[model samples]
Target: MRVPGSPRWAYGTFAWLVFFVVSHVVAVFFPGEDPTGDGPWDLRAYVIFNLVLILMSAVGAAVVVATVRPWGRRVPRWVLLTPLWLGSALLVVRGVPGMVENLLMATGIRRGGFVGAQDISTAELWAGLGINTYFFLGAVLLAMTTVSYVRRSRRDAHG
Candidate 1:
């Protein structure tokens, strides 16, 4: 709440992004646990295509974090902020509705999910809720980190 961009928040965001990416990498390496509960998502075919995307996302997140750190001031601001904003937007746009729908289904305030005629199970509902919530949290952390970097840059320039 104390202005999203702070030293502590920056560090936290980096940590979260690292954890998220590393976990996803692990999933790619060992796709034996699909959070979606679809079972087949854990298979080799489904996982092979995800590695590239995950690595690319990891690079972007690292860039954002690096730009916020002291060592990254020399890096072009736009280079980092562009992807940061886009990633944050993407996460929020995907997360909010997914979270809401999953929450609604979990609470029994709604019925099945958008996934065709498949009836949503309790475990799957909870899993979806957690995953979506993670996305929302990631969006917040990334946005805050960007704010911190921009604020620091502006403050340094003004002085």
Candidate 2:
């Protein structure tokens, strides 16, 4: 039996990984105005948050590379599966609720409060939009790639 391959998923995951890394780096260098509109932005907290984001993205990229590369075949299966499972769970937990809330707010069905509604400037609003859009897309892409990786791996093992 021939093991199935998903080159497109591999490449797309890599592309999103690049976007994730680059965007986080840019945010670190040029932190945007606060969207909370409550108090002075905490630079230390923001940097720490982005640092965590950068580390997570790095780990995600490594998982993607390991899933797609030949040498990855030699790595312990659990090592790759652990992060992939955790990432998928995180994406689903966050993204599903987020997309639901966004739809509800957009439809004006439930609008007591919404995330990122305190933008005081157009730039802030646009930045929030970009970040949200990137996150949603990345979550979806990551989920898809995770599925593809699992399927291909299973095929390789059983075939």
TM-score of each: 0.78, 0.77
Residues 51-123 of candidate 2 have per-residue lDDT tens digits of 8988987888888888888999998877988887787778777666666655654455554215534423656
Candidate 1 — number of clashing residue pairs? 0
Candidate 1 least-lDDT 10 residues: 33-42
Candidate 2 runs further than 4 Å off:
1-5, 33-41, 110-130
Q: Assess each prediction's global lDDT (C-alpha) against the native.
A: 0.71, 0.72
Best by TM-score: 1
**Model 1 lDDT at residue 92:** 77
